[model samples]
Target: MIFRTPPRAAILAIAFLLGAGFFATGAAPPSASAGARLALGGVALAFSVVALRCARMRIVASDACLKLYGPLFNQAIRWADIRTNVAAESGVDARTFGVRTPVIVLTSDRKVKAQPVSSYSFSGGTDTPADRIAGQLEALRQSS
Candidate 1:
C-alpha cells in the first residue's frame, strides 16, 4: 500500500475551496450547487495528485527475507530478524513524526519503524499515511 500526503499547494487549495463550499452552502442564503461542485472537484484533484506522486509501501516476502520499500525508508529483514508481528494504531502525532499523513506505527525489534514524509493540515486535522501503512503491514504479517 502506498501512503501519500498531498502537497502543500494542493492541500491549501482543497482546504480553501472546501471551507468556502461549506460556508457557501451553510450561508443564510445557500449558494448554487455549481460552486460546491467546483470546490469538490478541486479537492479531488489534490487527492489525485498525492495518489500519483507518493511512493507506496509494499511487502515482498521470500524464503530468505521480507523486503519493504516505500517513500520514507527501505529495509530487508531476514525471517530471523523479525522479532514479532503486531497491530497498532498511529498515535496522536500532528505531522511531527515524519510519518506519512495519518500516523500508523510498525514495530520491529521493540522499535517502531518510521519514515519522514510530507504531510499537510486539513480543515479537520493533519492527514498522516501511517494508518494505511500499518494496515498493510498487519495484513502482510497475518499472511506470513
Candidate 2:
C-alpha cells in the first residue's frame, strides 16, 4: 500500500517557483555582482534538487517492509519492527500550524519510519488525511 499526502503537486510547484524567484532576483538588480549572482544561482539549484527529491514524498508498504522516501533520508523497516499505533502528531502540530499536519509518526525504535512530507499550511487542517494514513498503516501493520 502507498499513502501520499494531498497537495503533492502543489508543493512541488511552489518549490519550483521559489527557486525560480531566487534566480530571477540575480537578474533584476543592476549592480548584481558576479559573485552574488553565482551564489543565488547555486542556492536556487540546490533548492530545486531538494524540491524534486522531497516533493513527492510517500510511504510504501509491502509484505516485507515499509519504506519512507524523502529529502532528509530514506528508511525501510520490516513490518514486524513497528510496535505501536501508526498515527499523526496532531496536538504537537496544532501548536505550530493551527492544523494537524499530515505527518504520520511511523515508529520503529522510536524513530520516524515514513510520512508524506509537507508543511502544515499546505497539507490542510482536517485531520482526515492524517487519520486515514494512520488507519491504513495500522491495517498494513496488522496484516503483515
Candidate 3:
C-alpha cells in the first residue's frame, strides 16, 4: 500500500499572499526595497511549489520492504531488518505549532538507528490511520 502526505494548502496560501503584496499598490517600476520584496515573494512562491511537490511523498509497503519518501530524505527498510513498529507521539514539539503529533517509530536490530515515520496520521484526523499501517508492517515483519 502507498500512503501519501496530506495537502499543505497553508503553505501555498502564504506564498500567494506574499506574491500578491508585491503588486497590490501599483504597477510602477520597483525601487530597491520593492525589488527586495519581489525577490522575497519569488522565493516564497518557489518554496510553495517545492512544498507542494514534497507533500506528495509516499510511504510504500510491499511484502519485502517499506519505503518512506520525504522532501529531503528517503528511507527503505526490509522486513527482516525491522524489529518492531509502534505508534508514539513526537517529543520536543518540532513544528512550533503547539500540536505534538503522533508518529510511527520503526525499530531495527541496530542500536543506533531508529526510523520515525511521521507521515501517518493516528488521531482519526486523516483518512489513513497509523494503527492500520503499523499493523500491516508488523504482519510483514512476522511473515518474513
Top-TM-score candidate index = 2
Candidate 2 backbone clash number: 0
True lDDT of residue 105, candidate 3: 42
lDDT-better candidate, 1 vs 3: 3
Error of 1 at 141 (Å): 6.1
Which has the greatest lDDT? 2
Per-candidate RMSD, Å: 11.7, 3.9, 6.1
lDDT per residue as tens, model 2, 21-110? 777574547787888878778777777766776666777788898787776568887777677544555544435553333333434447
RMSD in angstroms, candidate 2?
Answer: 3.9
What lDDT score is found at residue 23 in candidate 3? 44
Q: In model 3, where do residues sit more than 4 Å from their true spots?
A: 5-29, 33-42, 90-128
lDDT of 3: 0.50
What C-alpha lDDT, on a 0 to 100 scale, does residue 105 get in candidate 1?
Answer: 34
lDDT of each residue in 10-51, candidate 1, tens digit only: 544465555545544453244547766666656655544443
TM agreement with the true structure for every prediction: 0.34, 0.71, 0.53
Runs off by more than 4 Å, candidate 1: 1-53, 93-108, 114-144
Model 2: per-residue Cα lDDT at residue 125: 53
Give the Cα lDDT of each candidate: 0.45, 0.63, 0.50
